[model samples]
Target: MTDRHDVVIVGGGLVGASLAIALVRQGVEVGLVEAAPAGQMPAVFDQRNLSFAAATVNALTALGVMQQLRTPTGPIRRIHISRQGDFGRVRLEAQDYGRATFGQVVVARDFGEALEARLDGLSGLTRYRPARFVGFAPDEAGHRALRIADAEGERTLHARLVVAADGTRSAVREALGIGVDEHDYGQTLFVARVRATQAPDGTAYERLGDDGPTALLPRGDRHWGVVHGVAREQAESVAALDDAAWLARLQRAVGWRIGRLVASGERSAYPIARVVAQRLVADRAVVLGNAAQTIHPIGAQGFNLGLRDALTLAEEIARGDDPGATSRLAAYAARRREDRERTLAFSDGLARLTANPSPLLKPVRSAGLVAMEAQPSLQAFLVGGAMGFRGDVPALCRGEAA
Candidate 1:
């Protein structure tokens, strides 16, 4: 007989690592495989950040990852959404909604390293670094056999369940015969860390221009993470410009809300696409995170939604006698449909609408923003929904304050 575990997780990125930690806490023996052993750690001065909604924060807290973060985490007191060449705008304030803050922003590298440290201390968990998933097979006995290859040789692991958190181009999902519907926006997203001439003061801003959506999200020490989308044809030109020229162009589109956008660090650009798998499950194997669905980064919902997937799966595993049973998988799929559809539609719609240069959309968008901003009840719903508080939210996402 070979070595066996309760679950085998393929991928050790943010979502997969968190899932492993959560399951291990429940006393389930877990085996995690990562292609890169001791993946490159974040540099000291790195400042890329992620905007965490309240629900996402709650999820992290439950996994004990938040407790280790120790940087200048700032609350998102307000959000400003506006379109250039339009006379209307929408504003959401936490104070108006009787909440302390809408969300908080944390440096991505910091958060990732902290989670890695926690994973190191985890018990009942076996980690296979510098290893990759070559293939997997399953039987009617409700067990999965995984073939993993590494520097040493090949080994097989048997588990009651298998999770594919391997990202957008998932090998496991492909092995399960699951296909993804991909929508290429014909655009690219540029992300960078910058020192704004003005203080963000915990305010997140989004500028929707004919070009695309440009967001300035706050980070620690007055730094900001700027994410902007540009057409594929235009992205190269934008990325080719010097820092000074780039800052000038960015500030012109965003207005003078946060003062001059000064120094910028290493910049990275990636093609944007919306990917949704036809099915999320196959036998005893299931896909989560980017494997099941990969959406545009419009509202920064990609990773947040993935976190919810992990949390929901954890809840089921923690509560059920047989975690990988057919009934349990069905329940997970049912519970995730509403939120997934809502987010997918919102992201795709926003991407298409804002990228449209049509003169006819001007009036409609203007009026819509104005109305959305003025209605208190409607604003409340938008705020809550944007912060990942809607649909069938799991208990851990509520920040139980334990």
Candidate 2:
């Protein structure tokens, strides 16, 4: 006999695990399948810094995941954005919008561990670890039959709604023949932890140059999280630099805004790209997180956007009797349309404009920054986006019971 579940979420990463927890709270039977072993951590839970928007913080709090964090998180009181050779810069303060802080930055590993801890206590949830999703077949009873291979060997399962929370190269998505609009930016991002001469004062800096954007986000009381973008052609050399040499190169790229970089941690680099699925829903299956869309890391919108996807989809599932109903899935897609489009456009446009080397465009970029700082309306618009206030926010995101 095949095991049956109301919802079977593939890829037990941040988004997938969140969805499972949300559904289980709504009295829905959820089965979570993860490719990794029981004790192994997913790649998403790396040493990188994750900036959680206010909306995301609200949702996580409602889910009881925020309070469970064992690691410290740094508050983002203000954001300073500028171009290396530009005359103007923009500063956005959370106090201007009547908020304590715009967002909080947490180490990805810490956040992931928090989510995992919460998963263990959730009722009505089953976890299949060290499992691989072989394939799926359509069932006439409005469900999908899934095949899984794990340490215990092979088994069959059925799910009314199958969610793909896998990473960029989603196996479920590929099996369904979904295509993506992929754009390789020909740039690589180097991320690490660094100690600066000046102490972190709850401020985040985004310095854009001809090569790419370099961001320094407050990680804790003493260290700052660094994301340095390098051209693909020179990424290897930059990654090969010694700690002293790397610190020197980063100082040259970002200037003295954060003071000198004194110490650095292990550096990791990955190619940057913009990937959006051709479609979000198909039959009884739907995609979320990096599986549905992968945006540039310029504004730190990727994970926040994925969290919204999970929350919104969970809302839709909780409201209806049939979790796999086409109408519910359609509503999920419709609700995400506006937010997804705006975020993708903003991230992509920022990466292109800031990374452009044209001398003529420098003034244009600088003028835009100056205008944003001078105009309250423009600042509000951006602040809203940064806080994840776009479109029809779910009840959980609004700090309500869901």
Candidate 3:
């Protein structure tokens, strides 16, 4: 096997890249394996907008990752959530809770570019691009012998830990023999950048309808990031719509919240599903990000949760000399349990409950919304989660070193 590194991360996307940054900053030896070619962004880096929870912003800020962004991010100062044809609504202002803002929004493509720029500055890090993780086997040195493939051929690299940040359908996780409990939301999401007659005022809107939830998030470019969810059977029809027709449909769903949806930019669609790995750690290998849990995006919790995974794992690694020791991995799993479970349940439940139009559930749903509006404690609970302070938070989340 090749000379060992402290850790070898497969799937250098958002979570993996962040993990590499975190680990390297903490003085850990790191090898980053990315499937994309050199000088190119990964596939996950696209036009989709990522909502950075307060904690995420803090952690990335601590790593100096935010400074690398070429574009400014939109701050979420207020949030509005309401159901179509429903009697209740919930409005929250960060100022009401003594916070300046709940979070910020960054385009996935730009965020990816920023992550690349940040990663480049770390001269000690090893990057294997245009490469794929073939498989891993036990090493005599108590590490994993990873088979990595590139343009030349396959080569073996040993590492104390192997991370499957490979996303929802992780080949690394599968190679580790990890099974997942999966849920298909039966909903397809359409994403785009749109401009409204009235410019955004730093407020994000979630208009829930029987079809699904249509969200309008403030974007730094004075436009809005739109994520419109619809039933699977209707997805094709919506996908085939012309830009004008698409904006019209989006306008109908969003109502007058953001004013007229006058124009739209590039649009894309994909089905949403929840895939939770049954276990986080197996021997010297572990999963992070979507490999561990792929929750619905109704509340923009997916990436934030995955980022927490990276931060928590990084914290654990810093806590021990042997990064892949069984005791350390177990501790990492323990620290992640509460946050992971709560986030997964929150995202899955919110998506199902809000999109469900059953008359019986309507009153309960409305009552819950009303209570959230009237009860400060309840709203506190929500803002706390959205701000990334709910459970066992990593040091980076608290704006401290890991």
How accurate locally, in lDDT, is each candidate? 0.83, 0.91, 0.90
Structural similarity to truth (TM-score) of each candidate: 0.96, 0.98, 0.98
Q: RMSD to native for every prediction? A: 2.1, 1.0, 1.0
Please report how far candidate 3 places residue 211 from its true position, in Å: 2.3
lDDT of 2 by residue, 1-402 (tens): 378999999999989998888888899999999987777888889999999999999999999899989877889999999988888999999998899989999998898889888998688998999898999855758788888888888888899999999889999998878999999999999999999999788899999988788999997647999999999999989988999999999999888988888999999898998889999998889999999999999999998999999999999998899999999999999999999999999999999999999999988998999999999999999999999998888888888887
In model 2, the worst 10-residue window by lDDT is 136-145
TM-score of 1: 0.96
Put down candidate 1 lDDT per residue, 38-129, tens digits, no spaces.
Answer: 76652321445688888888778777888888777768889999988987888888888788788888887788777887898688999887
Ranking by lDDT: 2, 3, 1
Instruction: Report the candidate with higher lDDT, 1 versus 3.
Output: 3
lDDT score for residue 66 of model 1: 87
Show where candidate 3 strays beyond 4 Å. none
Question: What lDDT, from 0 to 1, does candidate 3 have?
Answer: 0.90
Question: Candidate 3 has which clashing residue pairs, if any?
Answer: none
